[model samples]
Target: MRTRRTRAATAGIGAAALAAAASGAVLPATSAAEPARQQPPPGCETDCEKVFDLSLPYDVRFTGWRDDSAPGGRSVLAYYIGDELHDSRELPDRGVQDAECGWDGDAQRCAVTYYTGAHSTGALSALLTADRGIEETDSVRGGAPGATLRQLDGNGRPDVALRQSTYDPNYADAPRYWETYLEFEGKFVRTGCGAPEQQPSPAPTEPLYGSCAYY
Candidate 1:
């Protein structure tokens, strides 16, 4: 319902991550015969941004940095368990459309968004649970943008709200508005009453992964 612009560093970063991931590229390890590689004199890049808070038991925070040589810089999220770097990865959404992160019940809930043409692309949402039970759920809500997520269950299960223009696309005016909230377990299930009617909207033709009901 409300919007906040994603930080500039995120611009096109998501797409870059996608490209890198798709390419299946890897850097080679240094050879034993060669002398130890010299490390560059680092600045306050990641530290100044506070990638992680060591005092906290857990945190999922977003950080950004500029790289002119890069298509548009970098947008990354770091996941921490205590002070250890549980995991970190590049967010290739191209821009920081919006993001939310915090512990829900006993699990960690994190999400972020970015722009894709005229429509908004809800990139990803992740649930980091105990015993290293991490679930990454993405939208089959493709080809469109504008998505919101909420944790309905006190135990941290998620409910997502996705909206897209269903009206004529030829005009500049925003498309006719239609929205639905899908709950996630193994896949999304209708959280509302009964088998609801699917509105006349331009739903994604591509198959939805997980238990998704985008009709």
Candidate 2:
């Protein structure tokens, strides 16, 4: 079970709406004419480097999306506090159709996502912390912003998805281990696949107070 909520006003926006955007459903603000941005693919490669600073600490809070339709709905935000290579929370899932991973040296954390959304209204935020200390760092890929990775499940269906970025400590001519930025874009995964391989029958974890973490 998750713990209590923590409220932070780093960004002024509703959480529910952010989650919706994370799901890839377009909002009123963006126009269809706007050229769609290319997304990243699953796994790590040297070619990803988009970064944005939410200017907030790592914590969970219930900003919006708290209605019965999406119970346990809240905006998740976190600062990567683990080592390189892998995020402890970024577990593999059979249901995950696609996945993308990134590491931020500035934040000193790793971020892995199953999907993405626009403007962070209803986006699900997962922290990239390791059970062990931090992981080792490796070569980086020059990345672009707003790139997404789409995943297809076992039944040839879309399951997990996410946005990602590669770390470049020297991005702004900063020193190694001193430079940090977020790269990549958001993702939209199928509804059924939670964190674990199997999920509850009724689908949509929120209604059942579900989370990505499954026993």
lDDT of each: 0.38, 0.23
User: Can you tell me which runs of candidate 2 are displaced by over 4 Å?
Assistant: 1-42, 53-83, 88-121, 132-215
Cα RMSD, each candidate: 15.8, 20.6
lDDT score for candidate 1 against the true structure: 0.38
TM-score (C-alpha, index-matched) for candidate 2 = 0.17
Worst ten-residue run, lDDT, model 2? 60-69
Candidates' TM-scores? Answer: 0.46, 0.17
User: What does candidate 1's lDDT look like per residue over 14-89, in tens digits?
Assistant: 3543454356532111112211331111222342232222121222223322222345433444443332334444
How close to the true structure is residue 140 of candidate 1, measured as C-alpha lDDT? 33
Could you give candidate 2's per-residue lDDT for residues 1-215 as a string of tens digits? 12221223234233443554455543211111211332222221222222222222222110111111222221222122111112211212211111223222212222222222221111222322223222323212112122132223322111222212222333332211111122222223323222322111222312111242211
